[model samples]
Target: MVEKDGIVRVGLDAGMNALVRPAMYDAWHDIVNLQRIDAPADGQFDVVGPICESSDLFGKRRRLPRDTAPGDVMLLADTGAYGHAMASRYNLRELPPEDVIDGPVA
Candidate 1:
């Protein structure tokens, strides 16, 4: 995991021969526990999404803070690099909206 300025970068794979992080040794990521902000974690877990697919997982047995749950915003750290760059509009699903965190405004 490499750091440029202050932001962390995370890589995610969609199975199908795709690999995230360790495979490429690109960026560093942190598994944030969006559920419980003040509690301790019992164990690690594989954070998944509701996309209904085998490769729709975010992290695998990652150690988080605690109390993560549905409707909570769990951030996949350091995903700004190849995350949006490799987005596809498959299954008629709309691409996620993008927000500009920095840089000059147009």
Candidate 2:
């Protein structure tokens, strides 16, 4: 994680290998920190990935929960089929099996 010029850049563990929409179609996915769900947004961040390429960005200037730190469980909503189809084993990354949930969990 790095902050400069009032812009915070957050690097996640996953990248284009796991989620390619943002890198491919410039898509938008709502990023939320489950651990800090009830907490108000702390600030905006440029969520990026571990990849070395510039297109590995996840989101730009996204508002996230305050004090969001490493190991925090974050979710990118609506990945759907596109994300799965575009997934790859780039840089020896593992493709996690899909866990399809058709509806809300009780």
Candidate 3:
């Protein structure tokens, strides 16, 4: 996480490596901080990745919990196949494992 020019930026571990639609098509993905689901959204943040490129940003001016911090579990909603199908090891980043459930998850 970083704060510069009064703008908060949160770096995510899951980047173009797992979802490239954001960087490739400038797509908008609903970013949710699972840990702060019930917390008030008092912070504006730019959700980014560790990739060394300006296009690695996933979201901008995102409203999230004011105390969003490292180790927080985040979810990029509505990715579908466009995001996952285009994932690549462009930065030599290893592909993360994915879980598929057979039925509705509790």
Candidate 4:
């Protein structure tokens, strides 16, 4: 994560290899800070991945918490249907791991 001029940029652990919807379709995914889900959005962000390509962006002008920082876990909402299914080996990046959350537990 990096911040400049009140714009936070978040680099994903997995790049286009894990999700291609955004880069390929200009898709918009809701990014939520798991630790501060209810906090007000203090700034906009360019959520991207670690790939070298310019199309590796996940979102632009995404609003998130002001204190969001590196190592913070975030959720790209509504991605279960297309995120992993569209993954590729581009840039030699590995696919993201899955974590199953059972029931209504948070």
Model 3 Cα shift for residue 97 (angstroms) = 2.3
- Residue 20 Cα positional deviation in candidate 4, in Å, after optimal superposition: 0.5
Name the best candidate (by TM-score): 3
Query: What TM-score, to 2 decimals, does candidate 4 have?
Result: 0.84
Q: Which is the winner by TM-score between candidate 2 and candidate 4? A: 2
* Tens digits of lDDT, candidate 4, 1-106: 7777876788878677787888888877888888887889986789888986888888998889877788889888777858867777776666778775566745
Candidate 3 structure quality by residue, lDDT tens digits, 1-106: 9988988899988777788887778888899999999999899999998885888889999999989999998888878766668888977998766654355757
| TM-scores, all models, native as reference | 0.56, 0.87, 0.88, 0.84
Question: Candidate 2 residues 1-106, lDDT tens each?
Answer: 7887988887888888899889889999999887899989977899988887989999999999758888997888889888898899988999866666588767
* Candidate closer to the true structure by lDDT (higher is better), 2 or 3: 2
| Per-model tally of clashing residue pairs | 5, 0, 0, 0
Q: Which residue pairs clash in candidate 4?
A: none
Candidates by TM-score, descending order:
3, 2, 4, 1
Question: Which stretches of candidate 3 lie above 4 Å from their native place?
Answer: 100-106
Which 10 consecutive positions of candidate 4 have the poorest summed lDDT? 97-106
Q: After superposition, how far is residue 70 of candidate 4 from its true place, in Å?
A: 0.3
Question: Which lDDT tens digits does candidate 1 get at residues 1-104?
Answer: 22236422223223212223423443345656555656676646655444546555556556754344545545555566576666666565566665545757
Q: Which has the greatest lDDT?
A: 2
Output the lDDT of residue 54, model 3: 85
